[model samples]
Structures are given as structure tokens and as C-alpha cells.
Target: DNEIKKIKAEYVRSFLFENKLMPSTWIVIRIDGCHFHRFSEVHEFEKPNDRQALNLMNSCAVAVLEEFKDIVFSYGVSDEYSFVLSKDSKFYQRQASQIVSVIVSFFSSAYVMKWKDFFPFKELKYPPSFDGRAVCYPSTEILQDYLAWRQVDCHINNQYNTCFWMLVKSGKSKSEAQSYLKGTQTREKNELLIRQFNIDYNTLPIMFLRGSSIFRIKGEDSVMPENGTFEEVKQEIILSHSNIIEDSFWKEHPSILC
Candidate 1:
């Protein structure tokens, strides 16, 4: 019994030490497409294609690296671009803001240039100015705000769904209930929903249901389950195959659903 106690204590201590020593300083950089105006006339070059979009995204990455060569450690671009640093560098954050600022400026200027090149004199209407003012170098908060704004502004036509569950006693259409639940209008709102409600673009309907349970349990009973974390619940929802959770599977297939 004494030897068993010593082994268990040693195992616990080692686990704690390993968890404590894990690095939390790494920086994750995500770069995705910004906004694009509809072409007045569908030129072969003007129409957005995966190949063209990828090329443009690559160009943006190159532009960022060229402007801030000293700060970037390593970067990659696929569907979206990302950079990972061994550790967070304040310099890189500063440079990221600068790069984003330049990209925004270039986007604005390029819009005008492309309009002139394509239309010449056909009374081209420029898209509305991104409500936010342009900056030479932006702060992280500003960059995040701008990115969020751009996302909503760019994808205005896309539909988002919110889910709701009421007790069997309540009589309301799920759609009507979900409408009252509210869709997020901003990136901050979405992030908060993901963190608090455990729902996001990638979350399945079943996952949403599990999240709903956890959310309700916490809200009403102040109780959490011992067997699962929020993420585990989310994963379980994804793995399950119930017809009632069809919406969840559809959420993961945006392109097909869209």
C-alpha cells in the first residue's frame, strides 16, 4: 500500500509538471480572402477562380513578407494563409498590423485601378468605403475589427443558422425559436458564442444540441458533467448519426449546402 501510494503521487506530480511546462507563447497567424467587387463585365481574368484566388493570396503573403522580412519566421498559404512562430514576437504583431494596413490600402487603390482598366468610362460605382478609416499601421484590435468587418461585409449573401431547444411542453417552431436566438453580427460576437455557447461555423447541429445541454445545465443548475469537456461533447455530436442532427452535418459541408 505504501509503494502504490508513492507511485500514484509520483505519476500525478509528473503529469502536473508536464502540463505546466507546455508552451503557451506560440503565435498563430491566419490570413484569408478579403472583399472583392463584382465585375461590371465578366472578363476571363476578372471572374474569381480558385487558381486566381490562390495566386492573389500568394501575392499578398509575398507582399507581407517583403514588407516585414525581419519579423516573419515561417509562413504558408493554402486555402488560407498562416504563419507560425516558435514564440510570440511583439515585433511580428506590429508588422502584422502594418501588413494588414498595406493590404487594405492596396485593395482600395486596386479597386479603382481595376474599374478604370475594365470600364474606362462606363460610370463605374465604387463599392462603399469600409466604414473604418484607413491606417498606415494598425493595432491588433484594429486589425481584428477590420477583419471582422470585412468578413461580414464581403459575405452579405450567405445564410447563418442559430439553433434553439425548448422543453417538450413549449410549442414553437424550431425556426421561430432559433430566429429569436439571434445570429452574431460581428467577429467578436461569433468568438464569444464559440467560447461561451460552443457554437461556430464548423459546429454540427448535434454538437449544437450537446452544447445547448451544457449551456443550459450551467445556466440553470450550475452543474457540469464529469465525463466530457465542451470540446468532447462537440466531438461526440459530430460522431453520432441521428437524423435529428442532420443540420450539424450540413454545417460542415458549407460549399455543398451553399
Candidate 2:
């Protein structure tokens, strides 16, 4: 038994570096689809934004939250998703590599598992994979900033893709569309959408611009004395397609972090 234990410990030693997350800090795991541009084309994703793909992504995110209760909030847009764990969490011993790896693996599996629900008639052309990384933030404000960064990126990329595709749909080749959008600022992009394409950029879906976030809320069935009583807590995960940069969101869901 002693020899067996020693050999088993050696087998597990290689994984020591993979799952370690910073102690007493918030853990954020972000996963991105690998080479999804070609994947989107092959799957016939709608231009501007694909609602089906977005739904699939959101579903996967929800699945992650369900599997990892410590993950209090999640945000996703386009081909990427970010999961935020509580600062006091001890999941997977708070290993960065373990947390990131499992989230990415589970997310990818969920995506593939639920693809049929989103695209029943459309078969998966090939296996889809995702890459992930874990980042630590000492403050909640910084975590909020990370979310804001992703939302800003979503707006920028969606705007650019919308313009590029609209131009292509109007008979311009891919190269021509790229050239036309080159060096164009945000104002220029908006003008192009309105003047040429007759699109109301402001009227686009908020989900396309700001992405989606899942906030988990816990409600107890009965009240208990804080002095010594115990209460049952039921968790509810709420999905929101709203701007998370403002203080209103944070204020509304104060218990998420604690």
C-alpha cells in the first residue's frame, strides 16, 4: 500500500501546475472559439449577428454556472465567454489551470452537445474547440472593467462585421469590402451603415452590442436568525442582456460576489 501510494502521487504530480488559481483573489476564466471565422462561414451563420450561435453560447455559459456553483456571474459575446468566480471560492483548490481547463472543456462539450438544439437540420461540419485562460483580479472594480472591455470589443467587432457584410451583400467582393472599411473610424462606420446601407445602427439589438451576463441569485425558503439558525438557500441564475458597465447593474445584484 505504501509503494502504491507513492506511485500514485507521482502520477498526479504533473497536474500540480495546471489547476492552481491565486488565493484570496477573484478568478475569471475566459474561453474563445478557435478559428471560428471559417467555422461560422461553413455553418452559414447570418451576417451582422447569428442569433442561433449566440443562443448556443449562452446555453453553454449557463451550463458552466450550473456545474460550478462558485461561478457567480458570466458574460459572453460573439465566440467568447468569461466566467467570474467569487473571490472567496475554493473550487478546484483555486488552481488557475484547473479552473480554466475544466471551464473550457465543459463549455466546448456543452456547445457540441447542444448544437443540435440550435441547428437541428444543420449538421456539425467538424469538431469545434476553444482556448481558455484564467486571470486574477484583486478588486471587484477591476473585474467590472474586464467585463466592460469585452462589451466594448463586442460593439466594435459587430459594427465592423455588419458594415463589411452589408457591403459584400451589395455586390462588393470580400477584398473590396475590406478595403472600403480600412482606416474607417467608428463615426465613419456608422455613417456608412446609415447613408449607404440604410441601417439604423442604434436600433441594433442590445445583445449584439453589450453581450449577455448571467447573475446567480440565492433566495432562502424561510428566514432564520443570524445568531445561530440555519436556513436553506435556493439559487436562481438570471440571464440579462443589458449594459453592465453602469453602476445600476452592480448595485442591483450586490450579493453576487459575497
Candidate 3:
């Protein structure tokens, strides 16, 4: 039996390829919703920006941060999120597949589990799914650039969606809305929203404009009422919608990179 087990283990494990992330480099596991458009449509999600859906995403992200201590930070918008693991992390021995799968699977399950909490009256039409990929950024500078790129994407997509939905709600067919928005620059879109819809694009919620950033900070550790002998510091996860592309955020949260 031992000889047979050894033979099977050697043969089967040999077929499994290892995809280890680069050492001394930050690991970014980005997960995106699979076919979220149809899911949203079937679930009757509010167009442009669904507060409940966005909140649910935020909650799931918070849960992920809480579960994975090695994940230093996360940035999310729309139906996708990018989680950044510390460069020195040894989680799953830095195996790209394990890290990506575990995070994505946990996030997907968290979304499903927390759905009812956020959308108390609405039933989830189906189990929402996500796809994930892992990439290594060799330096903090490159990681910042990657996050900035995602945030910029979030801004652009949000602006377009806001305009598109506003036009549709104003009785314009979806085709007409698309045509009107086509070839229109940022300036033109803002003009259209103000002139026609009286909506100030800048006045939109910061969460929609900048997306959400989840991370941990050192704070007072909780203790039972009777065990007040001493106080200690502990890591507490927090969510923010501030501008991560700027230096001030990094300066304020210096421990994130450390």
C-alpha cells in the first residue's frame, strides 16, 4: 500500500505544473466579475450605479482583507477588484495559481453569502462568478502605476455610464444614447450632463468617481470588559474612497508598503 501510494503521488504530482510568483516582488491578484452585465440585468440591478451592488462588493472586499493577513491593500470599482499582497509575503509559497484561486473563490463565495444582507428584498437570480489573474510588480512604483491605471479606468467608465443611463432615463433609446455619447470627449460629456440633465459630474459620489480602497491600520485591540489590565495594538481593516494615485495617501499610510 505504501509503495502504491508513493507511485501515485509521484506520477500525479509530476503532472501538476507550478506557477510561482516572482520573489521580492509584489503580487497583485485581480478578480473580475464574469458576465456581470447579464447578471445585473437578470437581478434587476439599478442602472449606471447600483448602490446595493457596489456596497455588496465593498463588503466582500472587506471580508477578503479580513481573511488574508498578507494582503496589504485592495482597490475596487464596478465589478472588479485588485488585491495587493506584500512583496515579502510567503502565502501559499507565492504560488500564483493558489493565491489567485483562493482569493477569487473566497471573494465569490463572500459575495453570494453577503448578497441577502445588502439586498434584503431582492433575490439573487444566480450565483455570481468571478475570474482572477495574478501578476507581479517588481517595485512599489510600478504597483502604484498599476493601481492608478485601474482608478483612471474607473473614472472613465463611471462617467460614461452615468451619461448613458441619464440619457436612457430621459426617454432616449439605448441606441440613441450610445450615438450621442460616441466621439464625445470628457469636456463634451460634462457639458451635456449639465446642459441637458443638470447633473454635475463632479458632484457624483466619490465612491463612483474614485472607487474604493481597502487596507489595514494599526489600532487599539479589543478586549473583554474584565480584562482591562493592558491595551495592545492590532491591525484593523478599513475601507476608503480617497485618491490613491496621489502621494498624500501613501504618505498618510506609510505602513501599507512596509
Candidate 4:
């Protein structure tokens, strides 16, 4: 009995060494696909935006939101998604390692498991994986800044890709397109897309440009017409591609933060 107890105690005690994240702070875990460039090529994804691939990613994010109640919102672009936990959440005691590991594992597994549903004819050559890291935001301002930074990155990358592809289609060599685009400002790119390609930058699909945002909204309680009985309804997760940087978004979804 003494030897058995010692073994159990030693193993159990080791887990506690991983520290929990600071409480009352917004915890965001961002996960990105590992080596997705090669994965996309091997799978022959459609350029600019692949509808099936993006849907598969969104489905995985929804699964994560359903699995973890503490995650109030999520924003994803390309091969990466960022999940935000409410400031007051105590899920898993905010244990960073456990939280990160569980989310990444679940998302990666879901991507693999649900591939068939999204891509019926295509084959999944092998399992795809993701890497995740958690960061604690001390204030809403800082959190918004982080979110804004990501959105800016998405804008820059999408604009560049749009120009590069248009140039390639317009008979410019890949290296020529690369050289021509180097050091060109955002205005130049928009003008090029307009004058040369006849593609208006503003008319692009919002999803491809802005990426995806997923957040929950509370449901209003309902009253029965006959008996005057009241019933509560479950909240819902809403997926959108609207601007998240402005005050209007935070004001509308006040429950997302805390």
C-alpha cells in the first residue's frame, strides 16, 4: 500500500508544476496550421481563397467554441484562428498548458476527422496538425490592439496576393511580378488592380479580405402566450466577417468580454 501510494502521489504531483495563467485577464489562444503551404499544394487548393478549405476551418472553429464554453469569441484568417476567453472565466483554472494542448489537439483532430464531410472526392494524404499558444491580455485596449494587428496583417497579405495573381494572369512572369510589386505601396497595388486588371479592390468578397469572426450572442427569455410562463433560451454562436476594430462591434457584443 505504501509503495503504491508513493507512485501515485509522485505522478499526480508532477502535473501541478505547470502554472495556471493569471486570473481575471482575457486569455487568447491562437492556433495555426503547421506546414500548410505544402499541404495546400499537395491538396491543390484554389488560389486566393478555397471555399471548401475555409469552410472546413470555420467548422473546426465552431466545434472548438461548442467544446469550450469559456471561449467567448474567435477570429480566424488563412491557416490560423484566435480564440478569446472571457475575462472572468476560470476554465481549467486557466491552466495554459492544458488549455493550449486540449484546444490544439481537438482542432487538429477535427480538421482530420471532418475532412471527408467537406471534401468528398478529395483524399487527405495525411493528418494535418496545428500549433497553439496562449497570451493573457491585461486590458480590452490591448486585446483589441492584438486583434487589429491580425486584421491589418490579413489585409496586407490578401492585397499582395490579389495583385500578384492578377499580374501572373496578365502575362507577367512570377519573378517579374515579384520584382514589380516590391516596395509598392497599398495605393499603387489598388491602382494596378483597377487600371491593369479591371478588378476593383473594394468589391472583393469580405470573407476573403476580412477573414472570419465567431462570437456568441445571448438569447432573450420568452413568455408563453396562454399561461404567462417564462422560459430561458440558450445563447448562440454567430459567425461573421464584419469589422471587429470599431467600438460598434464591442458595444453590440458586450457579453463577449466578461
Candidate 5:
């Protein structure tokens, strides 16, 4: 019931911010779980291999999506599902809260029915390891960026690999590496950085170390050497890593692996 209310509040908040709600408003909603928990009696099924557990999570997502079909386009069911509204106008603005209310009710009712079938109420507790929440929302540029990054192959470039890995590692928490990179100061530099690190790049290391080919280098402050010395390049590469680590964003959110 509490969770349901929380979701309802989120829906209201989203609608209020969007404003201009008339009809045919396009929106995307997504929901997913962060972790999985099994009932005490289902301890044997607690491991990640339990198909039944996976199904239950999927079922929850499906139920939410089905109930909101009129306002949603497609939903991705994983740890989260996304809903894209088909219309461009917001005719359902007034009912936004009600929509969320229905979703909450659906979640509570579904959880009760599904959970009771496998274990007693007293034994029912979220699996000890799950920290994820089911989330739904309209599409945002952030989502697009995330999808694009996910599609890229990280293995081809060491810098790209490192940055990608760092993003994921940091993403385990709520810190905003993606947004920080997208910010104005770092946007252009970050773009070049990503390109140089991408698998398609001709010389990933050269691009990574030289920095000038990728970023502006001026005098002693420059990341690369005009003389093209291997030792200088190597030192620069090390410096780049250090600079990335010391970045205000990265520093605030250290890599989980580190």
C-alpha cells in the first residue's frame, strides 16, 4: 500500500511538471526491479536461477503495462518497463493522478495474489538482495542517451571501455555520470573522448594518449606533445586517467569496483 501511494505521487508530480495536458500527450513509462528477494520458505529458490521468481517480476510489469495500455505505447519489461504514450496532446491531464492510483492498486493486488501462491504471508519478505524499484515515466533525453550508450560495443577501445565500465560501475548508485558528461563544459570533450574510445576508431590508444587529436592542447598545459614522444604520450595517458578519476562528478561517486 505504501509503495502504491509512492508511485501515485510520482505520477502526479510528473503530470504537474509536464503541464499543457490536453489529449494525445506522448509519454513513456518504465518499471523494473533492482534486486530480487524470495520468501523464507522459498530459500531454495532464492538464487538468481529461479525461473519462477523471474516470472513473478515480469508478471508485475505486465500487469502495470496492461492497465495503462490506453496511455502507453510500448513497455520494456526487465528490471524496468517503459511506456510510450501514442498521442501528442494531453487530454488526460486531470486523470493523471487517477491513472497512477489505479497502477498502485494493481500492484498491491497482484503482489498479494502472486506472492501468496508461493509462500505464506508471514514468510513473505523481499529477497535479501533486491534494491531495485519498479519505475514508470515519459521518455526523456536521458533515456535516449542511456539506450545509445548501451548499444555501443565497449571492448574495441580501452578508454571507451574504461569510461563505459566506469559509468556502469558508478551507475550502480544514483550519481549522474551520464548527465555530467552531457553538461556543457564536458559535452564536446566527452563526445570526442567517446569517439576515440569507440571500437571503430582507427587508433584508440593514439587517440586516447595524444588528447590533442581529440581535445585542444596548448603549450605545457596541452595533453599531448608536439614532438610526439612515446614517454610523454604515456605520461599523458596516465594523466588522463587521473584527471577522469579526480573529476568532481567521478570523485563524488567512486567506481564500485574501486
Candidate 6:
């Protein structure tokens, strides 16, 4: 029996690949909604942007931060989110598959579980899912660049969608709206919103424009003692919608990479 067990174990183990991530490198796990376009249509998500949907995504991100202490920050837009784990993290022994799968699965389940809280009037039509991938960034600069790229993408897509939806809502067909927006620049889109829709793109909610950023910050936690109450500074997870592409954000929150 010992001989047979040894042979089976070797054969099984040979088929498995650990795919460990590199040490001393930041691990970014990005999760994207699978078939979210159709999911949005089926669920009748609001056009351009949906506050409830965005709120739900942020909530799931907050949950991820709370569960994984090693994750220093997260940035999310639309139906996707990126979680950044500390470079020196030993979570799951730095196995790529394990880390990605666990985070994606948890986010999907959280989205399902918390659906009612954000959309009490709407019924979930089907099980929503997400796909995840893990990538390693060897330096803080590269990681910041990656995040900046996502934020820029969010801005571009949101601007286009805002214009497209506005056109559609004003009696233009979807095809016509697409044609009108095609090849238009950022400035043109802003002009369109103001000229045709009387909407100032800058006046939109910060969350919609800049995307959501989740990170840990030092905050006060009130503690009750027999003598009196005192405030203790502790790390608390928070969500914000601010410009991360600039040096100011990093300068202010230096502990994120440290």
C-alpha cells in the first residue's frame, strides 16, 4: 500500500504547477466582470453610470481590503477592480493561481450576497461572475503607472458613455449616437455634454469621474475605559475618489508602498 500511494502522489503532483509569483514584487490581482454587458442589460442597469452598481463594487472592494491585510490598496471602475498586495506578502506562498482565484471568488460571492443592500427594488436575474489575473510589478513606479493607466481608461470610457447615453436619451438611435461619438476627442465630448445636454462633465460625481480608490489610512478608534473614553489611532480601510495619478496622493500616503 505504501508503494502504491507513493506512485500515485508523484503522478498527481507532477501534473500540478505551483506558478509562484516572484518575491519582493508587488502582486496586482485585477478582477473583471464576465459578460457584464449582458448582465447589465438583463438587470436593467442605468445607462452611462449606475450609482448603485458603483457603490456595490466599492463595497466588495472594501470587503477585500478587510479580509486581506496584505493588500495595501485597490482601484476600481465600472465592473472591474485591481487589488494591490504588498510586495513582501507571503500570502498563499505567493502562488498566482491560488491568490487570483480566491480574490475573484470572494468578490463575486460578495457581489451576490450584497446585491440586495444596494438594489433593494431589483431582483438579481442570474449569478454574476468575474475573471481575475495576477501580475507582478517589480517597482513602485511601474505599479503607479499601471494604476494611472486604469484611471485614464476609466475617464475615457466614462466620458464616451456619458455622451452616448445622453444622445440616446434625447431621441437619437444607439447607432446614430455611436456614429456621432466616433473619433471625438475628450474636449469634444465635454463640449457635447455642455452644448447639447446642458451638463458639465466636471460637475459629475467624483466617484464616477475618477473611479474608486480603496486603501488603509490611520484613523481614530474610540475606546471606552472605566475612567473615560479615549481615541486610539489605528489603521482603518477607507474608500475615496481622488486623483491617484499625481505625486500628491503618494506623498500623502507614503505608507502604502512602505
Best by TM-score: 6
Quantify how close model 2 is to the true structure by its C-alpha RMSD in Å: 2.9
Better model by TM-score, 3 or 5? 3
Q: Which stretches of candidate 4 lie over 4 Å from their true place?
A: 1-16, 222-233
lDDT by residue (1-258, candidate 5, tens digit) is 999999999988886553233343344333334343324234445321234554554455456545554432222222333334444424255354544445545654675567655444345555332222222224433433332332221122233434444455545332454454443433444565556544333343432322110011212443645767533321111112112211352344232102
Greater-TM-score candidate between 2 and 6: 6
Q: Name the candidate, 3 or 5, with the larger lDDT value.
A: 3
* Candidate ranking (lDDT, best to worst): 6, 3, 4, 2, 5, 1
Instruction: At residue 30, give the lDDT of candidate 6.
Output: 97
- Per-candidate Cα RMSD to the true structure, in Å, reads 22.8, 2.9, 2.8, 2.8, 22.2, 3.2
Candidate 3 structure lDDT: 0.93
Off by over 4 Å in 5: 1-25, 32-45, 71-79, 88-91, 94-96, 117-123, 126-258
Span of ten consecutive residues with least summed lDDT in model 5: 209-218
User: What's the C-alpha lDDT at position 21 in model 6?
Assistant: 99
Report the alpha-carbon TM-score of model 4 versus the true structure: 0.90
Q: Give one digit per residue, the lDDT tens place, for model 3 in 105-214.
A: 99999998998999899988888899999999999999999999999999899999999999999999999999989999999999999999999999999998999999
Give lDDT for model 2: 0.89
Error of model 6, residue 53, in angstroms: 0.6
TM-score of each prediction: 0.26, 0.90, 0.93, 0.90, 0.34, 0.94
- The runs of at least 3 residues in candidate 1 whose Cα sits more than 4 Å from the true structure, single-residue gaps closed, are 1-24, 29-50, 70-80, 83-88, 92-258
Tell how far residue 80 is off in model 1, in angstroms.
Answer: 5.1
lDDT of 4 by residue, 1-258 (tens): 999999999999988786788888899999999999899989988877787899899999999999998898899999999999998888888899999999999999999999999999999998898999999999998998899888888899999989998888789898999999999999999999999989999799898888899988887754566767655447788999978877788888777775
Which 10-residue window in model 1 sums to the lowest lDDT? 209-218
**Once superposed on the true structure, which residue ranges of model 2 sit more than 4 Å away at CA?**
1-19, 220-231
* Model 5 C-alpha lDDT versus the unseen true structure: 0.38
lDDT-better candidate, 2 vs 5:
2
